[model samples]
Target: MKDPVDILSALADPTRLGAIRLLWDGEEHCVCELMRKLGASQSRMSRHMATLKVAGLVIDRRDAQWVRYRRNPALSPAVAAVVDAALALPVTEKAEEIAA
Candidate 1:
């Protein structure tokens, strides 16, 4: 909300970055899928997504029992560029391990 720095800082964590990377594909994903992808517990994933919401990086919708998320359509170009750059980097060890 303050600046691009705030968005970048929110993504500084492994889990948050990974979550954003998954959403960058342009499809909405439920919290359950995010938890599975990131190898995080439900509460942990919720917290990370909450951080994303507060930073204006993602948008969410509730579908009965599920909550789905996607990259915020209204995201600033500068902030979107930062997310794109972060995802372009090689996968982190933790990410690889989780995928494996």
Candidate 2:
């Protein structure tokens, strides 16, 4: 598990939170797919993903021209619980407000 502060900080952003919600299903998602769903530019989406990666909340793999992302499966039990709790929370309108 990463520093609790770092993990929590990563989830503070609406964009990253949106990405996490999309990934909560445990399915691999291409960057392009996330970009389309979130209405974010490629660079912005990638940058936010980098933050999530640094926080150890997500892992990625290069796939030819695109990168696929998924929630980190190896999170410590405590961290996993935190993430699960966050995901379980009902979505608010503010959380769905991803900037263009």
Candidate 3:
């Protein structure tokens, strides 16, 4: 079986962690919202998002031309625990600025 720590490690990236934090706070967000919030390019955000999806930390839904992401509530207990821990961290300045 794949190690859950590996999944957590994938989320440890600042960019990916920011994405997850945004989803946790907002429940769901679109690519554009994330791009603006993180001040990251579409390609960069997409790559991070794809990693999160592959790690099972987030899930995607399509709405017309937009793709929305949310924390995967059904994630494995270990993965969920990691997410919980991450959410408890001090929100980054960029995240806070965007959240305001």
Candidate 4:
């Protein structure tokens, strides 16, 4: 398991938070999809995904020429609760707002 601080630190970034939300449904999303939704450049989206991967909040697999990411399946109950709670909050602005 990753250190809690490292995981929390990764979540502290709004860009990462947004990406996490995108994967909250447990569905895998291609890097291009995330970029399109967030109106971000490929480099920026990939950078944040890399951060989530390091923190163990997400997993990535190469799908042909694309990379797809999904929320980590082995989250501790407490960590899962935190993620759920965060996602439950009403979005005053789309998280993608920060992604751009």
Candidate 5:
């Protein structure tokens, strides 16, 4: 698992946090899907997913020209708990506005 601080910091950004939320269901999401849902550009979404990967919060694989990502399935119980807690936090009004 990544350092607690790194995991927390990785999730501090709204984009990354939103990615995590989307992956929380344990479904692999392609970069295009993430971009469409998050309303981010390809480069920007890739950058955010890279950050999550570095934090050990997500894993990715190439699918033709696109990359797919999902939550790390091998997370330690403690790490999973932390992620659950973070996901439990309510979305902020600003984030809601962005989604709208």
Candidate 6:
């Protein structure tokens, strides 16, 4: 069985971290918004998202052509705590630039 710590480590990447941070603020976000906020290529963002999904850190729903993602509230208390902590941090300058 895969270690839960290893799953968390997968989400530790800067880019994936940023993506999770962005989703932390709101209920959900479309792929384009994530790509824009992270300034990542579609493929790159997709890969990171896939990692998060595999880690059970994120959940996704499709809206037409867009796939929206959000933190998995159903996660264990420990994981939810980590996600809450990440959301508390101020948005980074890079994230702002991408938001703009």
- Model 2 quality (TM-score): 0.92
* Candidates sorted on TM-score, descending: 5, 2, 1, 4, 3, 6
Q: Candidate 6: which stretches are off by over 4 Å? A: 85-100
Pairs with backbone N, CA or C atoms under 3 Å apart (clashes), candidate 4: none
Tens digits of per-residue lDDT for model 3, 1-100: 2467768776677878778878876388999999988778888889989988888778899999889999887877766777889778888776566455
Clashes of each: 0, 0, 0, 0, 0, 0
Candidate 4 regions with alpha-carbon error over 4 angstroms: 92-96
Candidate lDDT values, in order: 0.87, 0.90, 0.80, 0.84, 0.89, 0.78
What is candidate 1's lDDT per residue for 4-73, written digit by digit as tens? 6778788888889888988998899999999998899988989999999989999999999889999999
Shift of residue 12 alpha carbon in model 3, Å: 1.5
lDDT of 4 by residue, 8-49 (tens): 888777777888888999999999988887777899889889
For candidate 5, what is the lDDT? Answer: 0.89
Displacement of the residue 22 alpha carbon in candidate 1, Å: 0.7
lDDT of 5 by residue, 9-100 (tens): 98888888888989999999999999988889999999999999999989999999999999899999898898899889999986665455
Strongest candidate by TM-score: 5
Choose 3 or 6, whichever is better by lDDT.
Answer: 3
Worst 10 residues of 6 by lDDT: 1-10
Deviation from truth (RMSD, Å), model 1: 1.4
What are the models' TM-scores?
Answer: 0.90, 0.92, 0.79, 0.85, 0.95, 0.77
